[model samples]
Target: MKSGQLNRRVIVQRATSVSDGAGGQVREWPEIGRPWVKASLWSTGRGAGGGQSAVADVMQDNQAFVIRMRPRDIATGDRIVLDGLNYRVRAVVDPNGRRRELQVSIELEVPENA
Candidate 1:
């Protein structure tokens, strides 16, 4: 992967359980690392009816993205944050199998209301 292609900076976070001070643990996403990555829009999908509007129709948006960066300890449960949006990691792949680079597949889901 070319360094020039890594034009975007993103934050990687991992889920952790922290004491909530009420005798229970609360889930939290803590920043793990900030890395420069090459991000590409993989795909996008919208709600049914292909943009038809209806009161019962709930708009669902699924955006898939692929990021390439140097090999790291990223995992499936980890998340990538870009532009203040959180993306769930779906898959990780080492294309060349040489550990030189990693291709991570991440996705974001948006509801109609928000």
Candidate 2:
């Protein structure tokens, strides 16, 4: 809850639909706000396939992260970009119920060939 704990910079973005001039709408992620947050690694999981063939084994990394920052108008399905990586907001909570701080839970899944 202390300001000093918020050492990482993160950009909060929301999905917006814009007209593509073709009678259709395109989803765009626009920056809503940037805030200093404290990010902590909650959990991590790695898995591989049972059998490998010609293709390399797929490595899936699911990471759970919790970030704490000042209260803001953020919601689920919003994205938090940090260090060029995008994370999806899973849940948000006001830990103190005073609206002074928010504990946001976010998740990131990376699939790579190993």
Q: Name the best candidate (by lDDT).
A: 1
Candidate 2 structure quality by residue, lDDT tens digits, 1-114? 688988999999999999999999998999999999988775333221221111122212466677888999999889999888888887787765799878787777353552
Q: What would the per-residue lDDT of candidate 1 be over residues 21-108, giving only the tens digit for each residue?
A: 9999998999999999988776344322311222112222466677888998899879899878888887787776899988787878
TM-score of each: 0.79, 0.77
TM-score of 1: 0.79
Candidate 2 colliding pairs: none
Mark the regions of model 2 whose C-alpha exceeds 4 Å error after superposition.
44-61, 109-114
lDDT of 1: 0.75
The count of backbone overlaps in candidate 2 is 0
Range of the 10 consecutive residues with the lowest summed lDDT in candidate 1: 50-59
Provide the lDDT at 95 for model 1: 70
